[model samples]
Target chain A: MKKIESVKNPLVKRIKRLQKRKQREKEGLFVIEGFHLVEEALRHDVEVQAIIAEDNKNIPSNHSGAGISLVTEQVMKEMSSTETPQGILAVCSLPRQEKPLSIKERGSYLFIDGVQDPGNLGTMIRTADAVGTSAVILGEGTVDPYNDKVIRATQGSLFHLPVIKGDIEKWIEACQTKNIPVFGTSLNEGTTHTAIEAQNGFALIVGNEGAGVQEKWLEQTDQNIYVPIYGNAESLNVSVAAGILLYHLKLFH
Target chain B: MKKIESVKNPLVKRIKRLQKRKQREKEGLFVIEGFHLVEEALRHDVEVQAIIAEDNKNIPSNHSGAGISLVTEQVMKEMSSTETPQGILAVCSLPRQEKPLSIKERGSYLFIDGVQDPGNLGTMIRTADAVGTSAVILGEGTVDPYNDKVIRATQGSLFHLPVIKGDIEKWIEACQTKNIPVFGTSLNEGTTHTAIEAQNGFALIVGNEGAGVQEKWLEQTDQNIYVPIYGNAESLNVSVAAGILLYHLKLFH
Candidate 1:
């Protein structure tokens, strides 16, 4: 383990700025905080390049993740965005992206269109795992999966899932070719998923947080669904809608 | 607008520590910063004990709901939890018991049970307004809806609805006598709510972040439903589930 104490260190500055989308892309890495999350990364065989934890932090008093780094509370705070820093953060390789049209080897998969919030993206990932979705495809305009907030919000599930960045048009073509039925969520009637029987081999298309799926993507839908609402909220947050749809698909199919 | 420059000011100090829940309750008032949120609080008729904004630095913009206190950018930062303070915060009287459950009222209502995260609670409130849920009821162990983070996460919707704090058991009784249906979201039973059907009088009961509704609350359900999962996430964030259910309820009925 290495000790990093200087706030002025160039590597520290780079880690601090990883919160920004542009910086994330520039450095090809993002920050994941909290012990549970870092441990998940380790278990999944995801490459954790380095770690920074609080001074005098506990490490099972027995074993520790391979590349752990110790830092002063002040140094940890410098790299943290949360008010109560967890005293642990990891610099890890962004999950690799498979081809957009690529079919998952098994089970279910997810396709998100323009989900902009980091929390929503992270929550969707965690919920996807709960429902047994195989992989996640990020269509154009989706938020950066590597954003610090998104990583922390995923609650460590990020390391377990196959979340890939890709193009919607390509994804549609691929799913169609693979015989995977593509479903989309809509405010209009494409299919009433509640009653319609679900089958194996499928991927659901969740739209932008506000706009729904881009109008054109609806053309690819074998089933277009909507969760029933009793009130006047214009739409559900993207992640929530994805969760409901994803969970329903797994349960019924 | 009366300007407060001292960090020693009890109110300012209290506002700064709102990141911690214990401090927030002991102070009996939570801090709400930024123009949009404060504006929403004012519109909602939430009682404001004080106002510290940029323009009204002196003579504190005193009003019936709020004691006016004005301050400069530096002072505002001293009182804000956000890194980029928006030059304003109002110490509003914590809203009184939020449950406005009256099935006879013929509107959509939300029952949030132990949804722990403040952001999730706040986001649900924002989504509630978007979906037109009449009000929100805080079940046991639910995070305080008035916490600084929760208020901020509500966007401007914190001011749009009445969020009640109470025992759901009694509220369930009120709904029962009034003949309003009480529906709980769970991991089992009811058909997929692909299309939300809003009824004249119904309450949507949501549960914890990971676990669905508790057994006690589930017993009170007139209907038990679950959102579908098409992906790998294990569960939906409670707020996201609430948003989806709330929207679908309005869409179909």
Candidate 2:
């Protein structure tokens, strides 16, 4: 492979356009940079369009296994959003759940109704992976999972988990039809998580970062769990709250 | 009282300089941005040298109660590290823990030893606040709590909680001498967290991002608790793990 030095290369221009969600979806791919993420893609067997390494150094020996390309540092930087680039980037296929999950099939799942912060949503997905969540259902208003910062924050767990995007109301209804229980988190008299049995299989619903689980969703839920605050700090970060509830559910698993 | 228009204005220059650790220490002040954080500082009554609202066009009436200096939008943009400025920023004192806690007095506490990521450390502190931990001890290698990103993440929980910075070795000895049990988390056979009476006065030691808990400190701890993993992802992000454990332990509190 020869290094492409110009920033104006059509490939580079196309890749740079990936910063926009429309571009990413239109191309059916997302770009992740840094040496670690590239390695993560291969390790997870995610589909890759190409490996783009700048500086002509530290290229992973396995790059040859995939369609690899050497890109100039300038070209790579033009495509990366991070302030510091690690001389490596890759375009990987947007992974989907091998089979789109019906609420009935995913017993231990997380429903993200409207988590807007890419980092927060990413952390929750990463936490979901740690706690053995079956999948993450992106409800209305949630940020795109493929957002570069989110991909980075997931620390490659993004590859391992099935994060399905769709109408949350429909998903919730599907779960209801299938007898799959839905547990929403709220600040009110929602049951304390310790008192609930998340292991038998349930979908954990986490709401918007600020607005919280919508009132309608909370009303529709089979159970509402709260982490119970003993202090006057108002509320916990949404991702942090979801993480705690997810781990609590794991107690039964 | 007056809007400062230039990036090079003396006060603006000082604020920019305080972005660095050394300058912040020399000045005994740090700046925190975003409307949420400034409100937190206000609610907590942390001393504020000034509240600078860059462009009052979008400042909600509630965010203006502090007599904030109305500055040009450009000045706010210059002072902000975030791509989008939150319109409000504050220069606040580095608050000391109001009730300093030693190991013996702890029922449940978190010791973040050597956590380097400002966002992770801040989330841990925020988790500590939500779970009602006795204190969060920042040992060697931890990022300063007042780092702009961290302070924002903490959402003023830094002010609500006992957040003390101290030497790692000294804090370890203090715990041992006081006979307060230590719980270190690891991938190995640290007891599964769910099985323990985790609420009993213990200090949970979380360590650096790359390195697990220090072996020396690991040896000093009384009990080690591990959050069981169900997936191939090697580890949890430090803050998420901390939040899970902290909230889990709160079941007893």
Candidate 3:
């Protein structure tokens, strides 16, 4: 096992770079911190590039298969993004996005279009996983799933399902070709979700925090559906809306 | 209209104190920031104590009924909790908690037990409002809904609903006496939610983020229900779970 004692170490500096989107993109890797997330990465078979643990923190030296490097407190602090680092972190390779082949015949999917809030994106992914959605497709302009806030909010569910980023307009069109109903949410007008027949195969699209699903994408969907707001609340948070819709439309029996 | 130019002004000092729970409770007031939330306070008819906006900011001068106070940029910054103050804030009296004379004979309700995250509490309140749940009762250990993070997360839904804090055990017993079925969520053992019969009036109790419902609360419920996790994820976020359960058990027809 290698021991690192200085924050000035080149390896420590490189790990710190994973905090930024551009650096993550250039290196094709992202950082997962804390004991639970690191444990999740190994359990889910995510490619682990390296594990850095505080020298005296008592985090496992080997997470089943990945070797850990022991680093001094100062060194670990420099590499950590959080104010209070949880003693361990791992640099994992970003999962490759799947090329659109065809929509599955009996699969449930969630398409997020331009959801800017990292926490909202993460919660939605967790909801999508809990309901056994086939995958979560992030449209253009959505927050990065691997961002620290998103990953933290997911509570390790990020590794439980395939979350891919791609062109949402194309994905909706692909679903239509396969006879999979694509449902978009709209505030102005749409069939109340309860009126829509539940089906095993479908895709539900939720939009931005403010301006909802882009007009271009709404026009491409098979139909728009809404969770009727019975109270004075203007709208539900995007993630909460996703949970209600996915379970009602796809999972409830 | 009073114009406050110095951060040292006594009224300005009192307004800033509302950010703290003790101060808020003593004054019986909470602070709301930004145009949207301030407007919501007015729309919902919550009692307004004061309005502080940037001296030159073009916020509605009268806000229909309440008077506005112009403050210098530095004073506005000092009064605002967020990094980017929206150039406006309002101090409003906290909504009074209902006396809990008894549970509504035939009303849908959500009981939160020890949910610690401020954002989670806020999101759940928003969801409750969307589904028209009669009231949300926060258990003794739950996060304060007036915390800036929670208030921000609610996105003004706080003004749209009755959010009361009280004793969880007594509330559940009260519901039971009125024949309002109480449902508790658990991971270990329970009937699947989809299998439970949907009814018009019921109370759903969601527990802490890490710990599920307390054993005592779980034992008292009419039934314990679990949202069947169909994927590898262990469970949904507390707020997301609340959204799914509330809609399915209360709103879905």
TM-score on alpha carbons, each prediction: 0.70, 0.91, 0.93
Sort by TM-score, top down from the best: 3, 2, 1
Those runs of model 3 whose alpha carbons end farther than 4 Å from true positions after fitting are A1-5, A8-12, A55-67, A96-100, A251-253, B1-13, B55-67, B96-98, B251-253
Among the numbered candidates, top TM-score falls to: 3
Give the per-residue lDDT of model 3 (tens digit) for B1-253.
Answer: 5678888988778887888999988878899899889878887788887777885455644476566789877888888888888888888887665555457767888999999989999999988998889889988889899999999998888888778888888888888988999999998478988887767799999999999799999999999998888887888898888888888887454
Ordered from best to worst lDDT, the candidate numbers read 3, 2, 1
List runs of model 2 lying over 4 Å from the truth: A43-45, A55-65, A95-106, A251-253, B43-45, B54-68, B95-101, B104-106, B251-253
Model 1 per-residue lDDT tens digits across residues A37-70? 7767777787778777775464323224556668
Q: Each prediction's DockQ? A: 0.36, 0.65, 0.79
**Candidate 2 per-residue C-alpha lDDT over A137-227 given as tens digits, one digit per residue, 9 for 90 to 100:** 8987899989998988888888887888877777778788877788888886678777886566778888887888899988888888888
The sequence of per-residue lDDT tens digits that candidate 2 reaches over residues B1-253 is 5678877777677778888888888878889888777766766667777778866654434443444677788888888878898887888777644345466565567888789988889888887887778778888788988888898788779888778887666676777677777788886657888777655566788989889788888887887887777775677788878877777665453
Worst lDDT run of 10 residues, candidate 3 chain A, spans: A55-64
How would the candidate models be sorted by DockQ, starting from the highest?
3, 2, 1
Top DockQ hit: 3
Candidate achieving higher lDDT, 2 or 3? 3
lDDT by residue for model 3 (A117-209), tens: 999999999888888898899898999998999999888989988788888878888888888999999885678887887787999999999
